[model samples]
Target: MEPSSATVAAYSPCGSTAAVCRAVAEGTGLAWDERDLARGTRPEPVDPGTLVVLGAPVAGGAVPALGLERLGRVHTAFSPCVLVCAYGDRDPGHGLHDLEAIAPGLGLVPVAAVLAPVRHVMVPALGAGRPTADDLAAYRSFGAAVASALRDAGGLFDLAPPPLPPASCPRERLELGFTAECDPAACVGCGACAGACPAGCIPADEPYLTDTARCDGCMACIGVCPVRARSLSDPARLAAVRERCVAGWEGPHRPRLVMGA
Candidate 1:
């Protein structure tokens, strides 16, 4: 089957990376299906003839572990895949290359990759006021170009990228160790927290309990709680990390886009 359709499979906790997927989908100049994994969305394998626009944010200089896990669940090899990684002003390190390294094995034919800039999720001060008009414009154009390329290729496009940098982000496995709790006083048994959880770390039956061991402390539950029942047991850790990041951070990162080789 010839490739003509597009799908966006993204893991965005704070919405920045999701926006990149939107720009890329629109760029494909094709009606695209959105799989916003953060909002508890799951996608089925496609026809292998569609375009897979895979995207995620950087966590500790690599694609968020949960995102990477989720990426493995989706089907892509049969499709031409375009990658987009969103990161703070600081370097995204080997996150994009990490994704590239696995593309072919997943049955995805690599075509293009985009590295987008967004305000720092942890230390907003570092990449302040980003994904500005200029950034969004560039994202849209890049998406369009990739879409056009795939459509023109008629499923024949493939690019085998060089081996990615062996060095990963120094804190590739960095964990914030933050804890989340549901205040029974405030929680009304709403399933919002469980539903919004990307990792399904929240139990639907209880709906108030969090498996911190599995939770990455992305704070999705805290943000989506109806009564604001979810609270962080440890906020100081993130605050401290933010302070340190701002102390030595420098940026206003630039977007990196590459066409299929």
Candidate 2:
């Protein structure tokens, strides 16, 4: 079928990546749909004319495995796509390479890649602080650049070379250790935590509980919960969780280019 309008879909862990995707779509005046791959399913087949953009956050220098899996399923159906990796100040080598490896396998072409700044709430072992006005501006500027690129392929910003090998596929899984204790009394059984979880780790149905195995520790659930019942046990882990959860991030400097088949 012929592509109708540009469609931008993303698997955001926190909300920043989705925000960026929305910015690009809004700036470019294209149709946009966001799926919390953590909680939702991948989209169906789309036309070749449709511009498909997939975005994810970088966890420990790599894309979340679940996000990768969803992308893989839809990659083949969507070609000439835009790959965006959201991260803090750290380099985007692993994130870029991971997407590159998955692109061809999914029948999707990488058109461009970009690495942009995100606000990190959890103070890293080294860097810690709220994003400055300049930081926010930078993200918006990056969004504008992405918008330009979407409008005209050549208009995208060129990112610095990734730190890792172009094709190296590293397995840096997201570790969600216990940060604090959850107060069952505070949990009103609303299932908001389960619904908001990015990895679908938390089961919203009966026996509603968090499945740490699948949790990326984005804490979107905890943040969105109306009762504020969920809490972490480990302070360090909690900090890391907060960092991953609240860190508003951006994609690479440039969009990855997908070679035409």
Candidate 3:
């Protein structure tokens, strides 16, 4: 069941997950297109024969609600698909499990699942300098393997869902109250943060002001600020989160790839 082509869809606020998606697409040896869900654009309908690569960054212990919502809109018909979750050195928790559980409803069959380590948007110190050159290479290798499996399958019906990793973090970690704040002096009134905000919480008129109520704490605004003006509002809170992350996952971690039997 070789696919005609491949499409990579992702909701990466800080682009780490998107980078992994691209690497995997490159491995498939098929023509690939991308749909950035972070920008709030709707992805076009995918043909049944097209291979789909879907991914989102892990926020807390699971995928962000908005990422899941946008991905749910992409209806398919049992199309062969690969699932990916990019995490910030902390426990990937049930992110992959959650994505796999919903794959069927999205008209997708999970042929493979990947958990890639990337810098945490909220706490950069946790998984700093990640999705390194080695990480991308591994994603490409995994993609190639996925392509091989599809090429060997008799048809879509023969494809089986891969076994995903068990849940690691507790559900309590799902809601970490974090918000991006901007420094007035360093902020040059650039609209980059507002434009890059997936939640659209940052106002254009007052770019430095983040509507905390609406912000999902993705930290895209902090990443996009040219002057590095934006950051998590509370240093003590961030430190505590970082401490927990370090205590749980201190050593360097690599991407985890699971393929179908």
Candidate 4:
């Protein structure tokens, strides 16, 4: 059955995944209902006839558990849905695969999956200024293709799930354990970083300090710091990721799209 509208949900702290998800939604040629999980809002119930687009940034060689947890809040029954995972140049990992694995249990019928490449939060130089004009255009095209597939299918079950992207980088090598460190002196007491943190590790009372144990190291706090006070606490881990970025993801990489059959 053809969908009436689309709901786009993404847990993007640094904004890359959100940007990509928006572009894809625009390409679907449907009115969009947006849910930015960064705001700590619960996902609304998905209409059975509404197409759903869910996405998250890859962290620690996979999609962060928080992202998956937020997705679980969405209730749907046989709704056609698209899954996406944005990763730094290192590896796509099992993010897309894992999302697909949970789709059935969530009452979602997986229709397509996208593995997008974006600027690395930890190593900005890697995939820097990425998801360029060309990449976004490609993503839009992928979305249109998904729309076309839905239009032609008889029902959600008639369309086959998109093929999963193959994992490249070894999981062991992708674990760069570094939490954001805020410089107390440079902090101006603005709570932008605290609000931007998807992991909710930043306390509102003391925005400058992050709970490292719960921090996903998504770089959201660092990105939102107006004074540029936040930084990765582990220099050694930073260096290691930088080295890997240069060796593995130096040049431009196109997003991988698997359109539903």
Return the top candidate by lDDT. 3
Return the TM-score for candidate 1, rounded to 2 decimals: 0.83
> Which of candidates 3 and 4 is the stronger one according to lDDT?
3
Whole-structure CA lDDT of model 4: 0.82
Off by over 4 Å in 1: 39-43, 128-130, 151-171, 183-189, 204-207, 226-231
User: How far out, in Å, is residue 217 in model 4?
Assistant: 0.6
- Candidate 1 lDDT by residue in tens digits, 1-261: 335678888878877888887887887678789877666445557667678887888876778777877777677556787777888878787778767866776687767888888887666687787788788888889887776665565445444442333444664556556667787777888788897788788888898788888877666787678688887776677688888888887676688788854
Find the 10 residues in a row with the least total lDDT in model 2: 252-261
Model 2, residue 33: C-alpha shift (Å): 4.0
| lDDT string, candidate 3, 23-82, tens digits | 999999999998888886565578877889989878878888888887876777868889
Candidate rank order under TM-score: 3, 4, 1, 2
How does each model score on TM-score? 0.83, 0.68, 0.94, 0.93
Better of 3 and 4 by TM-score: 3
Evaluation by lDDT, superior candidate among 1 and 4: 4
lDDT of each: 0.75, 0.54, 0.85, 0.82
lDDT tens per residue, model 2, 41-94: 755565654656667777656776777876655633444555666665444447
The window of 10 residues in a row where model 4 has the poorest summed lDDT is 167-176
> Candidate 1, after superposition: displacement of residue 82 in Å?
1.0
- What are the runs in model 3 whose C-alpha is more than 4 Å off? 171-173
* Residue-by-residue lDDT tens digits, candidate 4, 1-92: 77889988787888999888888888999998888876666756878768888888888777777777877777788888889889886567
